[model samples]
Target chain A: MTFPADLVGLLALLGALFVLLGSLGIVKLSSYLLRLHAATKASTLGVGAILLASALHFSARDGGASLIEVLAAILLFATVPVSAQMLARAALHLHPDLAPPQPDSGSRQTVPEGAEVARPNHGNSAPADRL
Target chain B: MIAIAMFITGAAMLLAALRLLLGPTIEDRVLALDTLYVDALALLVLMGIALESRVYFETALVMAVLGFVATVAVAAYLRRGRIMP
Candidate 1:
């Protein structure tokens, strides 16, 4: 059970590159939401690749497939989206102005008219009001 | 190869830290922290490969779990002004 060192190295390198790019996006992106988009999607893929490399390297060295790495990867995949969604919603709630404007002529109206009227006032109240 | 991977991840972590420091809003800082932990997880896995040890994997696993919980809790607090209802 010998994994090729070259293959493991390549996977790790690729994963690290993806992680670097994602972090770069976090610093360079103009808005918090776009940064969130980069951080969750890119870094998850990056970490997943790194975990695969780890499993492969260790499985080869120990003569047994390492499944714990797989578990970690799965945990990461499952949790990242939930956290990202929560963060995005929190951002929207805290800063209503950050929300994108609705189109003038849309086939479907996502936000009701009354809610739209009330949204601006939300910013005026202290955030603790929602608690 | 492992060294290179570790270096890249380290750089990524540094970039995330920069965002954490310079982020204009609380949400941006939260996002940066989230990215930072994920980068740390990647680095730990890379370190495990470099050291030829399985022990680091468990640490990485714990880190991933804790990081997720922390991110979610902060986000919940920010959204509703309370973590637990």
Candidate 2:
């Protein structure tokens, strides 16, 4: 079973590029929460791409599909969002001031649970002062 | 081609490490560590492909599982001030 070297190379190159972008985002983003968003979202896709390239490469080289790479990818995909959510909550808990202001409208929907717990009076005041 | 990919992956890991070192808060450090592990996993997979070896794949799998568990545990600790409620 022979595979096109160029095709595999392309996948690997793209995967590496995305992974680099994600890490660069972590370094470049100003705030902790935005960095979390960047790392989790972009890096998950980046790892997925690399795993995909590996799966394709192995399946072609060995004449059979590689289940391990697929499983690893699935495990990563399943856990990233959960970890990101937990970390975001933790960040909010540790620093409620980092939470962005509620929309000008009366209703407040996106406030994190940790923010509510940490700053009960945060609802009435301006986040800028807190920051 | 694969060598270039490996080089890019290595650079990513270095950038993540820089964040881990210079991050102001615990949450930032944790986020940086998480990104580091994920990039490490990607690097392992790329290594497996480059070396035509199966062991790197298994190592990557183990790393993914461990990294997820560790991140969750740390996050839980940060949120509730305890690993277990």
Displacement of residue A106 (Cα, Å) in model 1 is 7.7
Chain A only: TM-score of every candidate?
0.76, 0.75
- The TM-score that candidate 1 achieves is 0.85
TM-score of each: 0.85, 0.85
Question: Which window of 10 residues has the lowest lDDT sum in candidate 2 chain A?
Answer: A104-113
**Displacement of the residue A123 alpha carbon in candidate 1, Å:** 39
Instruction: Give the alpha carbon lDDT tens digit for every residue of B1-85 in model 2.
Output: 8899999999999999999999989988898888989999988888888898988977888898899999999999999989997
User: Looking at model 2, how many pairs of residues clash?
Assistant: 0
Q: Summarize candidate 1's per-residue lDDT along B1-85 as a digit string, tens digits.
A: 8899999999999999998999889999889998988999999889889988778888888899999999999999999989998
Model 2, global lDDT: 0.87
lDDT by residue (A1-131, candidate 1, tens digit) is 23478889999999999999999999998877888899999999999999998888877777878899889988999999999999999999999978776663342365565562333454565643431
TM-score of chain A of 2: 0.75
